[model samples]
Target: MSRQVKGVVSMRKGAPVELRTVVVPDPGPGEVTVDVKACGVCHTDFHYREGGINDDFPFLLGHEAAGVVAEVGPGVSNVAPGDYVVLNWRAVCGLCRACRRGRPWYCFDTANATQKMTLEDGTELSPALGIGAFLETTLVAAGQCTKVDPAAPPEVAGLLGCGVMAGLGAATNTGEVGRGDSVAVIGCGGVGGAAIAGARLAGAARIIAVDLDDRKLELATTLGATHTVNSGRTDAVTAIQELTGGFGADVVIDAVGRPETWKQAFYARDLAGTVVLVGVPTPEMTLEIPLLDVFGRGGKLKSSWYGDCLPERDFPMLIDLYLQGRLPLETFVSEKIALTDVEAAFEAMKRGDVLRSVVML
Candidate 1:
């Protein structure tokens, strides 16, 4: 049977989203209905509302979420009703060339539900990242749900679904940051801080966090940064290089996704050190580096998409670390908010007042 679920919707571009009743059809052959318990208000959500991602107006926003599997369609073997799960964007298609090459993380194709949750008038609503969870319940492809430790709190677990996970994966997975390595992260937002924490968890000897805000620097310290550099007052590359004996860090992640910061990350790393780009940059921006420098920089220049995460493989392992206190996932939750409070949370994020504002549905 179909159900009427309340969800936050973006009716048009650059307009305030509204809470409305969305009709969710029963789980199809390979879909599940999640009773979303909590979701985080990510910058991506705001971007979607601003029509930054695409012209999918009437989008069902909010993706960072944890929930209970309320129902599953037939042939669902991985999850069942009542399983606590963290929703992930990548539902790998085993047939993709990347998967065939044994790199499932780079799977060229992923899957979401074949069905669509539509508006009251039956107009199809595009879901942000194909897993909208800002409402009481959301429907998605069963594969998009990754079951994690049941004991984990919604606020903390939900973060693993998106930004937090992305940062962690960028360091540990994409950059291949290793033990006793010196790592520098630009932009101490939720994603950057997660990279710091992930670097620590991966046994990095020194983790340097670079940001423009003091508050964010303090939070980065709490997340396991060995040092903090407020770039607003200093040359970031020189500062990072000085911190690392003028050789720069072993790995530098550009989480701010701007040309200036990416350049900093480029110049602030040791020879052949990895430079990981996890920040989302807009089309209006273009970067140009000296050809000689680009040729002389004998290192990996990589971009991290969703941290190159394999949700089914990474989420549970992270939840285990979070539960054991080896990972400080809880620190990412700056505040717990209600659905209606998302707008305010965005404001808080803009002022650098909070690390993350999780919407407890």
Candidate 2:
């Protein structure tokens, strides 16, 4: 039987999302249905609303979520009904070349529900990140649901599904930020802040946070930054260099993803130091840098996809840390909202007012 539930959907480009009846079909083979407890409003959801992601109209726009398995289809054994799980976009297929190489984090074949969720009129809807979580119930590939510690609150645990995981992974996994190293993170948004926290967890000797907004820089400090640089008022590269005793940081993370920020990250690192780019850039933007500089940098320049996260490993470890008070995941939940408030939450994100405004379903 099909289920009708309320969901936040983007019907057209640049239009506000509307709460409408979303039709979810019963799970098919290897699929599971989630009873969404909480879903966070992320900038990617806003991008989908603006048609920045694609022409996939009527997108079901929430991905960062924590929920329980309400039902499972035939042949599904990864999770069962009543199990608490954190939804992940990357449902790795073990047979993929990337997985075959023992790097499942770079899984070339991720999974999603084979069937589509739609409207009453039968218009097929694209789920954001292949896990449309803003609805009361959503269907996904069984592998997308990774069971985590049930003791943590949904509002906090759900963030590991995306931004938070991205930042932490950029630093810990992609950048290889190490103990006693000097690290600087450009752009103190949710992802950047998480990078700072990750650096702290890695025992970085110094952590510098750069941001255009003072409020964001201040918040970054609470996460683990040793120093804050207001790029709006200072030359970011020079400031970072000065803070690092003129040697530059050992690792610099470009969480902003803009060309200028990337340039700063490229120049603000020591020779052979890593520069991690975790931010999502638009297709129209072009990066033009001197070829000689790239050769001279002589270090790893990498991009982090989903923070190079293996959901089964990272999510559980992070949830355990959060429960133990070692990781302060609570700071990321700026507000709790209803499904209808997603459009407004987008505005708050645009204005840099909230890290996340999660929908409690």
Candidate 3:
């Protein structure tokens, strides 16, 4: 049966989001309908509205979400009705080239809901990250709904669906942080702080948090950063080097994604050490580095797309860790807001007032 759901919609580029009732078609094949309990406002949502990600409009914004699986389509066996699950953007296709190579985490072709949700006017809505959840419910590929420990709050587990997971994956998965390794993460926001926490969880010897704001830096310390660098006051590259015994950290994560921060991350790592670019930069900005430096640096320079994560592999494991009291994933939430407060929350984010403003339905 078809369903109607109330969702937040961006009618046009650079315009305010409108809350309206949308028509959600019943899942067709390999899809599931999720009764979204909580969704987080992410920068990607803003980017979609600003036309940075694509020109697809009007968009159904909001992706980071957790919910109860209310229905599943034919051929779906990963989840069942009434399962408490986290909604993930990436639904790995086991047959993708990346998957064929045995690295499912790099799955090249992901899946989404086969049925389209549309506005009242019958205009098709492009879901933000393909799992729009700033609504009563949303539809996604069944594989995107990963069943985790049902005891965890939807608000907390939902965050692991996006930014939080990206940050943690940047450190633990892409960066491959290990015991006795020294790491530095630039931009102490939600994703960056998660990298710090992941570094600690992986038993990194030193974790350096870099940011202009002292408040965020303080939060980084709470997230297991061993040292803090106020980049606004001091040279970030120099600070990282000094903190890591003058050789620079083994891994330097650029969570800010600006050309400036990317450069800082490049030089803030030791020779042959990795520099993980988890931050998203605007298209207008360009990165420039000397060819000699590229050759001289024997290590890898890679970009992390959703932390190169495969939802099926990581989501449940992380939730179990979170439930065990080992991972303080909940610390990333700054405030819980209603759906209507998303606009104001975006303003607060622009002013650097909060880490994340989650919409608790």
**What are the C-alpha RMSDs, in order, of all predicted structures?**
0.9, 0.7, 0.9
Better of 1 and 3 by lDDT: 1
lDDT, candidate 1, 109-159, per-residue tens: 898988999888998989999998888989999889999998999999999
**Candidate-wise lDDT, in order:** 0.92, 0.93, 0.91
Which residue ranges in model 1 land beyond 4 Å of their true spot? none
Q: Please give, for residues 58-128, the per-residue lDDT of candidate 3 as tens digits.
A: 99999999999999899999889999999988888989888899988887888888788998789999999
| Per-residue accuracy of model 2 over 199-220 as CA lDDT, tens digit each | 9999999999999999899899
TM-score per candidate, chains pooled? 0.98, 0.99, 0.98
On lDDT, the leading prediction is: 2
Error (Å) of candidate 1 at residue 6 is 1.2
lDDT of prediction 3: 0.91
Return the clash pairs for model 2, or none: none
Model 3 clash count equals 0
Tell me the lDDT of candidate 2.
0.93
